[model samples]
Target: MSMKNRHVLGEAVRHLILIILALYTLAPLLFLFVNAFKSNNEIIASPVALPEHWTLQYIKTAMEAINFGKALGLTFIITFFSILLLVIVSSFAAWAMVRSKTILSNIVFLCFTAAMLVPFQSLMYPLLSVFEKMGLKNVQGLILMYGGFGLSMSVFLYHGFIKSVPASLEEAAVLDGANLFQMFFKVVFPLLKGTTVTVIVLNGMWIWNDYLLPFLVIGNKTGSKTLTLELYFAKLTSGQYGNPWELIFPAVFVTIIPIIILYIFLQKYIVAGVSEGAVKM
Candidate 1:
């Protein structure tokens, strides 16, 4: 074969592999969607088969049982505030660490970076203990917990991006009489948009899909239960031997809708931010 033919063959093979992988990843979602419209008997009989009739009955049942509206709203509130606080606090923390010459600042920054290695499961019990003692097992409390747990990586990303930022811009802001908060917010923060988008989407997805931490801190019984926690309890009454595919699948579908929409909208930002941050790092 000629060189051009070999290159075309390689490109074709690559596209074929990509298409296969995409189908592999999306298969479970497709299965869930198909089964969401199926009755329990139909789902059990032909798990991968398309439904005989698309019906909203299971979805309606799941939504009503789980109080889908309330859980979704609570989840949105927690994820939004958690990302907002994480970006704001992590940005200032990272910027200060970059600009400050103090040994303490270095130590604190090192501690935060080191914290990324600590598994959430290891600290789960003690963290819940502290929260329970202080009566912090609520939506507000969960947001704060997310901020703390999310800080390590957020600071790490911000720190790397901040290092690439020229100090001259901040100095110019100071010359214009910008105070610490104003300098950071107006001058420094705006420049960190790429890293900020990276942080928000990264942390937003984690906080939104989180189950263990929220389940531990705020029990599934609470009015503040998140969507994942709601899903957990949705199966409680299904008995020991059997699964409630009808209710469960529809609830699962409903639960993921918001995050799906969010990703579709902000996927461009995610790509751009990741590329920008990677370059700076």
Candidate 2:
């Protein structure tokens, strides 16, 4: 074979492998989706094929059971505030740790890194008591808790990323007699845009999807559950295996759609951030 023809064949082989892997990964989702449309008997009979008689009855029943609107609102609120606080608090704390360079700064940085490894599961009771004592049981409390918990990871990422930023930009702002706050907002922080976008996207997704912490902290109170919490209920039931999968698929799709939209819109930023982390390291 000619060299060019040989290269084309190699590319084709790689493409075929990727296609197979994609289908393999997607198979379960496809299976669930098809079975969702099938009746219980039909689903058992044809687990992998399209339903012969597609119906909206299962979807309607699921929506009624799930209480779609209420569930969605609850999820949105939890995700929004949690992400907001996680981003703001983590960013500020990270900026201070990396930029200040004091003895306390080193200690703060270490504390966060240490906190990340501290196994949050072990601290569940203590954390709950602390929040309860502080009267943080509501959404505000939940946001603050997410902020604190997410801080270590966010700061760790931000600290490393900010360290790679050139300090000369801040020095130039200072030369013009800009105050520290002004200098940070206008000059230093803005320069960290790439890193900031990266942190936001990363933390946003994490906070949006986390279930355990919120479950413990927020409880199963109405109007406070997150999408993750909603899905948890859908995943299993007490002594029940007959629940239709289609009932939960719509809610699952709702949970994921935001992340999909975000990635589509900011894919370049996300990719650049991931690349920069390795290069900086």
Candidate 3:
């Protein structure tokens, strides 16, 4: 075959593969959306078919039953504060460990790195015990828990990115009478935009979607429930006979909208952050 023909054939193959992958990813979501408008009987009867009668009542009922607005609010609060705490604490710790050369600092950095390998299941009971003793079961408490769990990986990412930053700017800031707080926050933190965005997006998605941790910490709690936990309870409340597919589908869709919106807006930054983190020191 001619070289030109071979190249064209290869490109076609690649495009075909990409299209297949895209469809594979989108198929379930498409199914979910279609089923959201369907009644439970219709969904069971024709799982993949178009809805016999499109309606918004199921969506409305799901929203009300799940208390989706409240769950969304709680989720936003947890995700926002978790990311806030993770960024602040991880960035500072990364900066300090990178800049300061001491035995204790080295040990601390090593510990953080090591902690990343420790499975959460191993620590679940102990973490619960400690948090209970510390009274950290509410939204504020969950924020702290998320922060602690999120810190290690975040610090690892930040630590690598921080090393790529030149020391001269911070030195200049210090020479110009900037104190430690100003030097780190004003001079250093702003430069970490790429990594910070990466950390926030990564942790925000996890905390928002996470079910098990919140279930354990805030199970059946009247006023405090993350979106995922709310969905879990909704599923249970439906039971086997009274299958509430209509309710489940819309609730799932509503729960995911925020993260989808966030990703759409910050997608460029997320790409930039991952690229920078991957290639830079």
lDDT of 3 by residue, 61-90 (tens): 888778888988888988888899999999
Whole-model lDDT per candidate: 0.86, 0.72, 0.87
> What is the alpha-carbon lDDT for the whole of candidate 1?
0.86
TM-score of each: 0.93, 0.82, 0.93
Candidate 1 off by > 4 Å: 101-103, 238-243
- Between candidates 2 and 3, name the one with more favorable TM-score: 3
lDDT of 1 at 228: 90
Backbone clash numbers for all candidates listed: 0, 0, 0
Itemize residue pairs with steric clashes in candidate 2: none
Mind sharing the TM-score for model 1?
Answer: 0.93
Runs of candidate 3 with Cα error greater than 4 angstroms are: 239-242
lDDT by residue (1-281, candidate 2, tens digit) is 99999999999999999999999987876766676566666656767778887777765555555566676676567667776676667767777777788999999888988998988778888988988998887777777777777778777766777778777887898899998788777876776667667777887777777777778877678656666776677566512434555556544655666776775677778767655643564
- Model 3 scores a TM of 0.93
Evaluation by TM-score, superior candidate among 1 and 2: 1
